[model samples]
Target: MRALFNDRGRAALDAAQDFCTTDALAYGPLRSEDLTADGSSLGELMTGPVLGPLTVANTVGFTAPVAPVMIVHGVHDASVEIEQSRLLAQRWRAAGAVDITVREFDFGTELVPEFDHTATNVAAYPEVIGWIDRLVARA
Candidate 1:
């Protein structure tokens, strides 16, 4: 993931900002501390004598997009707060993007019957696929 912050990967990210008729689907998306959240695996491992890349992969500074995006997260996820998704949506809307969707779910809402960081991806697949189908139809 650190490679995403390098010169070559940065160029790709810069180009993604100009999305044209594309769709984004994020499930239980976790944010790094740098992206204005509480948890970070890198932070935990990057201790003394284990230096690493300074740049982290996150959407903290991403600007508004030309295409629509959907972010799904669990309401009671212990590892990552749903607030992170809200913050991203707020930031994108503040930048003038209006099509960002942040979907939140609770336990017993799907086949898995539990909604957490890992559970969201599996439980939400049925609805998520339909969303992708709709997005494809629009395109």
Candidate 2:
């Protein structure tokens, strides 16, 4: 997901924090495996507003861990505005996210150069996998 949607993510988090609740959309860096169980339903839905339901993690209330997050984005992403990730990184940090990494790829000879929304998935796979592995190890 784009994380923060027109500041709604921020608003939701703020409301929860003020109300002493935990039902807001908890920011997370989703990986492919995380969506396999949905049979690619999420794949089709992510580009649209259908994932709105996922904004609430648990209806009954559960405290999602403020896990370390890393947003690997292509500066030239066609589907999502780079600003969304930037604002999300900022908001998540302000909300007490201890570890937030925004690794961006521009149009140079750097990692994932000539980046695009879908290209990032293949170009940055190794780095993304490593980050996930590290997080899992910590867990």
Candidate 3:
């Protein structure tokens, strides 16, 4: 699910962090299973605004000017599924986004063939910071 709505994954984390009043949530690369849940949460948050008309525009339209988006997820992220990212990438491509890059890394729960989710294994700071730096510089 996190993969499906990579756009809001971080936002949900932010919300959760604020709501929890602590940094209990973790971030890192993700796996397919991790996405099923995390992706759903993020999607819900994003679509909530869209469907509830919380934003200026009520729907996802091509005319909306959006900046380039960068997503970084761990391949072994058990909290969110890796496939979610694939789905989102497809949607963004369909939406005519040229600079969207979803970077997948290897830092999360141990690789189990049939697992759905795993615990975060590493701090996703350096790489994430680098990506954000590049994006900001480009912007």
Measured against the true structure, the TM-scores of the candidates, in listed sequence, are: 0.53, 0.46, 0.44
TM-score of predicted model 2? 0.46
For candidate 3, lDDT tens digit of each residue in 1-139?
A: 2334444444654566466322433443444234333434434555553434553264443342277666666676555677776677766778778877677776535455233232222344566678789878977
Off by over 4 Å in 2: 1-65, 108-115
**Best of the candidates, lDDT:** 1
**Ranking 2 against 3 by lDDT, winner:** 2
RMSD (CA, Å), candidate 2 to true, equals 15.1
lDDT of 3 at 60: 40
List model 2 lDDT by residue over 7-123, tens digit each.
443354356556521232243343443433343444455444556566544222133227776788878775577887887777676666778777887653346433346676667
User: How much does each candidate deviate from the true structure in C-alpha RMSD?
Assistant: 11.1, 15.1, 10.6
Task: By TM-score, rank the candidates, best first.
Answer: 1, 2, 3
Give residue 12's error in model 1 in angstroms.
27
Q: For residues 94-116, what per-residue lDDT tens digits would candidate 1 score against the true structure?
A: 99998886778777434533334
- Judging by TM-score against the true structure, name the best candidate: 1
Which 10 consecutive positions of candidate 3 have the poorest summed lDDT?
113-122
Q: How far does residue 122 in candidate 1 sit from its true spot (Å)?
A: 1.1
When 1 and 3 are scored with lDDT, the better candidate is: 1
